[model samples]
Target: MIPITMIPRSEVQKIEKPGWVLVFGRRKTGKTYMLRHMVRHENYFFVTRGGLILEHEEQLLYPVFEERIKNLLLKDITVVVDEFQRLPEKFLDLLHYHSPDSRAKLILVGSSFSVARKLMERRSPLLGIVRPVKVGLIRPVDLIRGLFKLGISPELLLRIAPYIRDPWIMRFVNPGKFRRSDVIEAIRFNVPALIGEVFSEEDRVLTDRYELIIRALSLGNSTPGEVAGYISGFIERGLRSQDVKSYLANLLRMGIASRTQLAGRKRYLYSIESPLIDLFYYLDTKLGYYEIDVPMEELENLASVKEGTYFERFVVDLIASLYGARVQRSLDPEIDGILVKKGRIVAAIEVKMGDIAREEIIKFLERAPKEGEKIVVAREGPSLEGVSLLTHRDILSMAMNFEQRF
Candidate 1:
């Protein structure tokens, strides 16, 4: 067994608010771990699917467990319950009547995305009682800062750093033995299980249509038209572009997919959000259902080609979020992304995972948007004559600022 490294979750501070808290996020983003370690509670319970509750490490039936929770809350003691959705309606009503008035601070953590949203509906008994805390994947900057503590070099770190966002990868990333293959290995084992759990939590079943769309996005078909076309090739019943767009909305809300509008057009581009998820689906597509038996060398070669694209996206997302801005992809093939804040374009960014050539920089200079700031980000390269050059060193600065802000 491999030891895991623990990092502070920046969202924990939000749980410190005065009233009750409802913490929810996709599974494996570490919601349970954060609430267990970072919050103050007098009693902790884990509710099982069959209505059996494990309180203080002792299992009890619904009646006994409900009474214990009531007694603690009435005594003004804080309480935490993981998988609160699994409990009966009575448990929710118990809190609806008691949580706000009682001095007890209630921190409930749940993984079901569907149920979590239902709690905010008009008829919910606890609708206005608890503050909602959403936890997403490890922020790019926070993940970078944590990995830097392992003394990993900047260039090598960029190669596999995105995989570390999945909490399961924490087990595979040993300080001295870590390498790109180590991450790939971790993905090989975890991706299927992770996808299943996420879908299960969302109360979704992956039909053939869902798989086709996910695979299409993995292979770089980002537009709804492209996805519809791709799926048509695989099935007799074809979906319209508008239908594809509607389906992608659920994924965007769940944080599994992301979309960026075209710079000047109303159309959008879609892609998988998690790097591990992207790579896994890419491998599944390439192997044509032979993913389980793919050779390590073949898997490594396939993953290498997509690493740069994922890295470019990471830079785009990190930079855009720093300014509380939105990112748009341009129609020009040469331009990667544009960051916009309050309806004004602030920068046009070009990210190169490999060395930048003078001719390449010159080409970018000629084609990139002139009204906004011009910037090129690379691992290591000579300075451009007129553009801002950012490197992993600069990213470190951003990472530090990001941690402090959260």
Candidate 2:
């Protein structure tokens, strides 16, 4: 297991008082990893869904409580329940029952939104007793800095860092500047050929062809029809509307795609978490489908297109890290970002991939009501009238480094 720090040790130190904490994040975001790391210093009781599930809720929970409080007569014991929502709802009362009497601490961790929603619903036993904390992707800088400390050569870091979306994964690889063909070759081997690995095997196929379709949409096919057409033509597979929607929905939840409506046209934006995925989707053919129609050379050439959407997703993730709760995506005129702090507009940003045009800047600015601060992000440094130009890197860095001003 690769250790990536999401919350600093100092932050955990501040939570000395006994209370309920609900830590959550998307799948594979290292929530349980950090929780286990934190509990090592204390006499902690770890309970999971599988351990507590039974037809009789109380019977399942009573044993857990008895075991947790067993032989601990010192300072308050900490109880960490991963996937707490999966436990019977009645278990919430059990948690509330022992805390005041034994002075024990409870930490509930859940990964699925469905679980979170059930726990947060009104009249739910866990409602109002939990403080929600969302864990997100590890920052690129933190991953890079940690890798350097771990004896990974910086020379390799700069080379492979840009390709990996998960900074923790990328910085660990620490290869040199990757050629498009080289990375695609890696994808051709890594993306599985079995549908079971990529999707539910009973229903899906692990066709690299589907991944290529997702890549095509991410690159620039914002509309559903257009994206569907691109995928069908590229793979020569007759695609359906439901297929597109289901696949896209999965991608959005994974933080790999985003969607919004503008003038009745729903635009789906790609959140490229891994540049390697991007390169694989764009360049590699052998990995996606059961069979290949495009020549290997042509596929490699296809991946060579300048990727702007990949950087856009990076910006979104960076901003999400900084302003997790304060940010909202705007629907009017398709602006890339809208930030509100303390009920006031703080910053509005839109990312343009290349060639900052004055008219385009004006069009984007018009989406905002001219409140607070506004900035435009682009690949090239351009001096535009009435607009501040920010490099893609600078914008991403600022989002990661943003501090709440309210």
Candidate 3:
């Protein structure tokens, strides 16, 4: 077996809860990793895309696999099915049949839309018994704690957070020999294949259009109109804003894209959910790096130049998750994110990727929501009048407090 360092996730707390369960997420988010390490099961089966099943030491056809599940479940054994989405439609019935009356605990792990729809939608047979837990990219607090345990400083973790929280991305990182270039190199080398794996988790239709849409978002074409306009330049007969909207909706459902309400407006601004993906496509759009060879040094420089955009997005996601807030976007330039808690706008956050100018922080403080919180997240900053300045040290403290509370 290959040696690997597994990052502990807070999702395991949810996954360890009693009873039958369904865990789902976008591909490459480490659904299988968490299942294999954090949860306990007597039998683990892997269902392949071609409907073949691998159990302990044997490969079985669907009928044989179904029979095995029946036998084990009858004995009340804990069974985990990885890539459960690839199983036949009748698999749900098989689950519904044994799960209710038997003490057999079942864990079904999958990443596709079908698994989600069948198990989460209103009519699902297992809906009542199976608890659905979505395991996204590692939670920032969990990641912060994980890094701290590994003897990495909070200062370094802030730099690492944007690149490594995806779990799979950490494979390329050497914690002791940390460097920004290492993370950039990981993206340059791995993202194309990573995205292909993400696509495989979906039904894989209109692939070219999907790629163009992601590329468009990376190019800052965030609105439906902007996305349609950008994609139209490549295809014949053009596409309407509505045409791109459905595709965006699909991406959103698949957990590949995310959107936030444009504050005080019905419209929303969309972006790729994973900043790593955004940066990958952004680099591709800017340099055609995906199509031709670019020297690793050149790629690193280019990634550094555009780091602020993706870093700000990462901060917004991280802070929102930390504070139990929803992300709100605005046309306002001074603020990077408007955080909402319980439907009320709670804070305006400024994410600084470089030296913070005294005047810049003042400008943001003056424009930030006056009532709640004005947070400046940066490496370091002047205490400045009364605006709350937060560094990774503060964040690490928060994560520790959060962990203690929960």
lDDT per residue as tens, model 2, 1-406 = 2345532322243333446677765555556666777554344444544665332234346455545444342246676666665555566776555445555566777665445666688976778777766654555544444434444333343334345434334323324333445555545645433213325312245466557556765466655566677777666666776677777776654444555433223444443445655455545333442245456676655664634445454454445445542445565556667666666666677776655777777777778657756777776655666666877556534643554331
Task: Write candidate 3's Cα lDDT for 1-406 as tens digits.
Answer: 1113445687777777788888888888888877777777889999887888998789999988888888888775778999987887888888887775667788888887666777777888787888888887777777666677666666666766766667777777777677666666667767888777767677666488999999999888889999999998999978899999999998888887888898767999998878788888888888888778878788778777756776687777777877788888877654699998887888889888656878989888777777568889887888886778888678677776774222
Kindly report which residue pairs in candidate 1 clash with one another.
none
> Which residue ranges in model 1 land beyond 4 Å of their true spot?
1-5, 75-77, 289-292, 402-406
Instruction: Please give the RMSD to the true structure for each candidate, in Å.
Output: 2.2, 7.4, 2.5
Q: Whole-model lDDT for model 3 versus the true structure? A: 0.79
- In terms of TM-score, which candidate is stronger, 1 or 3? 1
Q: Tell me each candidate's TM-score.
A: 0.92, 0.59, 0.91
Any runs in candidate 2 off by more than 4 Å, and if so which? 1-18, 38-66, 69-77, 83-93, 100-102, 122-124, 139-168, 175-257, 260-301, 304-306, 316-385, 391-406
Q: Give lDDT per model, in order.
A: 0.79, 0.54, 0.79
After best superposition, candidate 2 residue 370: deviation in angstroms?
Answer: 6.2
lDDT of 2: 0.54
Runs in model 3 lying further than 4 Å from the true structure: 1-6, 404-406
